[model samples]
Target: MNIYFNCMKGIVYKELIRFIKQKSRFFSALVRPLLWLFIFSVGFKTALGLAITPPYETYITYETYIVPGLVGMVLLFNGMQSSLTMIFDREMGSMKILLSSYINRNYLLFCKMFATSIVSTIQAITFLLIAKWYGVDISFLAIVITIPVIIISSIILNAFALFLSSVIKQLENFATVMNFVIFPMFFLSSALYPLWKIKDSSILLFEISSYNPFTYIVEAIRFSLYLKFDIQVFLILGISLVITLIMAFVGFKSKKVNHG
Candidate 1:
């Protein structure tokens, strides 16, 4: 147990050090979400008036409705970027150190997940604080409760990213695949727009968004931010947790092929 704990500590510290050194990463993370919040939200609010619904006691502006989804977006992007970094490290032979350090590959992968999850969760919290500072109101207690949700959500996203990193053959090709994955995942979900609103416009889009896994994550956070209860939130998370574990394991097993 001590060995495992120390191993995690070393990896997490390395990740933090890397994050600190790369100031651009931190800024970009902050800027992307803020742009959407400050600029895009303003444009959309006038174009599309919002309605009050579950997780919201009052009629919310586009900015308020999208905050939770943007929070998820932060984690989603960071997780994918982190995976890209791993792919680079693997190509550059940096990941060889982990193969040698830990006797088991799974623990090493878990350490990677743990490190990224912590960093992602911290960023989510920072995003929440900034959102509040921008005049988007949410309960303080709900923010406190959001910690666990962020942690789990980050882990799932990070684990999912790690699995992608393990399968994607080269670092250069990652960008194309990432765009293909990220944009659809973000736009098709209830993140930028509400599902009810989507349903009003087009039944086909609403049905597609309904089956999207990312929508559930956004909904989970959106509902949790207001301290609301929804069993579907937990049910979705539970299902995602199992799928991520299994899929990540497959990625771990396929590391050799990924390198080739």
Candidate 2:
């Protein structure tokens, strides 16, 4: 029992130290979303007006509506980035050594996922604070309530990327996979614009966005920020976390069996 706890603690500390050393990585994570919040939102706010939406009582500016999406963006990208580290560790033989310990492989993977989720959650909170400073209107209470939602969303996303890492054998391949996964997931979802807008633009996109797991994650965060809970969103997120963790564990287990 204590061994498991200490192992998780060590993994979390190592990830934090690595994140701290990579100052550029942290900045880029914040910069990507901030650019969307500040620059892209400014240009689109006038061109595209948002109507009253769920978790929002009245019409909102594009900036306000996209805050949760940007938060999702932080989780999504950081999740993928953490998987990149996994691949790096694997290729460097560190992952093999880590798993060589008596610790269960699945638990180790979960620890890694949880550690990265913590980093992603921190980044999301920091982004929200900056958004508040920039006048996006997130209250302190909302931030507090949204913390657990952020953690859940982060875990799901990290599990997703971890599953992807098991299939990807090389760092180069992950870059391609990340592009294939990240952009389409971001653009197709209700992240930047609402689903109604997507429906107006293209029915195909609307249908796809409805099924995108990232959509539910974005919505979960959005509603949580308003102190709202949607059972449907929670259900979807719960299912996603379970599915991804199972797939990720199986994927990594196959590799271990084959290599051993």
Candidate 3:
């Protein structure tokens, strides 16, 4: 048991060290979400009149409305970024070494997920602090409540990335998957606006948003930020995590067989 714990600790430490060593990567991870919150949200605040959501007694600025989405964006991108790093590691032969360790593969993967999720969640909280400095009203408790949700969301996203890595077989293919998968997931979800806002324009788009996992993630964060719980968010996130983990497991298994 002690040996297992030490292996997990080593995995987490390696991830943190790698992330810190790559200063450029850390800055890049931070930049996109900041742009959305500061530039885009500021410009759209007047143009987009967001209605009062629950826990908000009166109408709020568009910037406030999309803050949760920006947090979600941070997690979403970071999760994918973790996947990209994994691919890079595999190409550099580091992943093979890690996998060749006597430690359990599933536990090793979980440690990877946990480490990446911690980084992503930290970025989200940092983004929130910056937003608060910009005059966004957020309770201390809300910030506390958001931690687990961000962690879960990050894990789900990382699992998806792992699944993608298993299928693509090359680091070069990651960019293509990001373009095809991440962008659409971000834009189509209620991350930028509420589902009711979309309903005003087209029922189909609204319905699509309702079904998207990203939508639930945004909603989950939005609710948590208000110090509330959304059961549906828990349900969707739980199910997505299960499915993505299964896919990742299958992918890892295939990789093992091929290498063997």
Candidate 4:
């Protein structure tokens, strides 16, 4: 038990240290969401109706409404970024020693995923604080409550990316993955708008977004921020987590069997 805990701690610490050293990472993660909150959201604010319904209540500013989704964007992008780092490390020979340290690759993969999740959670909190400064306020308790949701979302995303890594052979080809996977997931999901709003725009877009796992993730985070329990969102997130875990496990196992 101690050994496993120690390994997890070491992995997390290493990731944190790497994160600290990469100042650009901190800035970029914060900047992307802040740009949305400050720039794009401002323009879109006028485009959206005055009434946003629940989560944001009947009346709220666009900045306030998009806060949760921006946080989700941070997690989503960071999750993919973590997987990119993994591919980079593997190609550069940095992961060679780590892979040999554990007999079961999944255990080590979990350490990486969990640690990346913690990092993403921290980024989410940082963004929240910045949002507060921008006049987007939520209760302190609500902030604390959303931590687990962020962690779970992060793990699911990173695990899914890890599964992708198992299939993708070349590290240099991540740009294609980003274009096809990350952006489409973000744009199609409820990250930028509500399902009802999307439904109003286009039924086909609404259907695609409705089935997106990230839509549920954003919904879960949004509900938590409002001090509400959304059973449907939780159920979706739980199932997605289980499915991604299985996919990652199978991906890693198959990869190992093939490599050996």
Winner by TM-score: 2
Candidate 4 at 138: error in angstroms?
A: 1.2
lDDT, each prediction? 0.85, 0.92, 0.84, 0.87
What's the CA error at residue 192 for candidate 2, in Å? Answer: 0.2
TM-score of each: 0.94, 0.97, 0.94, 0.94
lDDT of 3 by residue, 143-230 (tens): 9878998899888888888878778877778889999999989988989987888999999988888888988888888888988777
Regions of candidate 4 where Cα sits further than 4 Å from its true position: 50-52, 257-260
Candidate 3 has an lDDT of 0.84
- TM-score-best of 2 and 4: 2
Model 1, 1-260: lDDT tens per residue?
88888888999999999888988888788888999999988888899877777878888878889999999999899989888888888878878666655357778887888898888887888889999989998778889898888878888888888888888887788989778988888899999988888999999999999988888888889888988879987799879977986788788776553323
**CA RMSD for every model?**
2.2, 1.3, 1.7, 1.8
- Candidate 1: C-alpha RMSD to true structure equals 2.2
lDDT of 4 by residue, 61-139 (tens): 7788889899989998998898888888777766656776644677888989999999999999999988888898787
Q: lDDT of model 4 at residue 170?
A: 91
Candidate 1 vs candidate 4: the TM-score winner is 4
Clashes within 3 Å, all models in order: 0, 0, 0, 0
Clashing pairs in 4: none
Rate residue 154 of model 2 by lDDT: 94
